[model samples]
Target: MSPSHHGTEPVFDVTGVTKVYTSGEVEVRALAGIDLQLFAGEIAVLLGPSGSGKSTLLNIIGGLDRATSGSVLFNGRDLTDFSDRQLTRFRRDHIGFVFQFYNLIPSLTAWENVSLVTEVARDPMTPDEALAMVNLTDRMSHFPAQLSGGEQQRVAIARAIAKRPEVLLCDEPTGALDSKTGVIVLEALTRINTEFGTTTAIITHNAGIQQIAHRVFQFLDGRIASMHVNEARIAATEVEW
Candidate 1:
């Protein structure tokens, strides 16, 4: 069946996608026929061990990488058909990414770092609004170095969501922080997903983190080993790491 006929059409429709890389004489299959769908206004977590294709899938969905075979559709448009320039525009206009390292500029204040993307975005929220959403409004004037690790990550999240992108992709967003700090960051992420209604996907190795997701997919050997719906997702603050 075509993806459009699904009960709720997915924001991301990945079908039988595969990615292979060759290092000298050795070839690695990073993704082995991944078929998944991520719907709107939901938090989906991809859980897996290293090299299990979690990041690979995220990259493909974000249009940062291409698959060797099969197709990925975003809002029903085939991503495989987009040219490089088109892909760039698509990513810039429709997707937001948050990484584990909290890649904020040390020289810039929190507001400034968040505003950088707004300056170039076609339509964006004010830096104040974005910072407020992440609970960093009071620290808007603080530089990355001046903020705590969790705060820095919050600033990164602010920067990403400032553009009001349709999709938010997080790659182990709390990986660099301690468990307590990570929960704070996750709380901020959860707030964003709930308030903004952005379709969100997070990649993580932390099984405990999955409790905060509306749905979870476990990756094994570069394929989806299991998928389960979470009827009652605990708040990030309530979940133990």
Candidate 2:
């Protein structure tokens, strides 16, 4: 499905963004210079190998990390200029992040894990509603240890969506799961995007997953090598590793 370019303004406008990590005398450039636009309500798949700077760019846009140079504008506001407190609020109020590992508190039930976000969000769905989004309402009371890996990931997704974020940033969300289980997680992600019209960006090593996105970006050596619109997007179930 093609994403709706509802407005001329992009959700995220990244320009000349670069990231450099320093350790002692060594300075490693993670991002050379990135110029990208993430439109509102679009599913963008970033494909690259390890150390390709896809994750670094994702982190910068998500407000998890700062760029060494250049500007990152979110809805016309310059994120790179924001104070630490403002960045924290920006992440909490607008961005939902899902990492490769399901970072659930083992002691917390699925419902509780999701509730943790709803409790702090400005306008959040109920934990029940979030669990229902992932088709995990029946397992809401189960602990993470009792659930399978896919189930745990779904719960983590539920927690992220509970806050009704405007943007969902996922870094290798399905990397830890098998092909069968990964598709299940992808289904949940696509469903959420369709339902909420959330601007979603996913970084994945699985090139096949790009077929499910509205647009695909190929990263190489800390820069975007190529980008294209997927005119004939497929469903999550149709994606293969």
Candidate 3:
């Protein structure tokens, strides 16, 4: 997880990636010829308006969906050619996803929710350790209903990272929270990215969150309209959002 371990290899190499959704009488292009490289141990933020294709690209990169044309390479392997089973195993063994909703089991304690993934992971950290990483160790036995929104989201993050995945892809992670609560959640994510060196990519509608990322890619009309590096990265607590 050290910065030293991050070599020149790109974690993701996407080329000519395009996604087209077909219905009865219409074909919608969600992504258009996206060619980019995401390096190891870097935090990349994808920003755009609704239907701008940021979420679509995130899903494709996370293995939840596939590009209709072109190739997606992860560490030199072509993901576009991977079978269903291969994609499932790739997601299970190497990717972690967080969405706007916590999606925690109401009946299970925080510890139990995270343990579910640890049980299936190849070399997972303990549920307790995962919870502690998000600073929720004291609430290990608390149910989702018993915790606040941010706490629940942290638990969800714990569950995602319990498997020790190399990539953490979060889609609208703080969309449902108030500003104060959202800041805490962002801080937790920042901490996790720094501590684990997990290559993190966040899809957010909030433009203010761009300051927190090492690099930002702005999507528009199904293409990356702009991309820039934040030489002076802002901490989550200091982020204007």
Which candidate would rank higher by lDDT, 2 or 3? 2
How high is the lDDT of residue 214 in model 3? 85
Off by over 4 Å in 2: none
Top-scoring candidate (TM-score): 2
Clashing pairs in 2: none
Candidate 1 vs. truth: CA RMSD?
2.9
Query: lDDT: which candidate is best?
Result: 2
TM-score on alpha carbons, each prediction: 0.96, 0.98, 0.96
**Per-residue lDDT of model 2, residues 31-114, tens digit only:** 999999999888999999999999999999999999999999999999999999999999999999999999999999999999
Q: How many residue pairs in model 1 have overlapping backbones? A: 0
Residue-level error in angstroms, candidate 1, position 15: 0.3
State in Å the error of residue 227, model 2.
0.1
True-vs-predicted CA distance for residue 177, candidate 1, Å? 0.8
Error of 1 at 13 (Å): 0.5
User: For each candidate, how many residue pairs have backbone atoms clashing (under 3 Å)?
Assistant: 0, 0, 0
What's model 3's overall lDDT?
Answer: 0.91
lDDT of 3 by residue, 32-140 (tens): 8898778888889999998999888889988999999988899999998999999999999999999999999999999999999999999999999999999999999
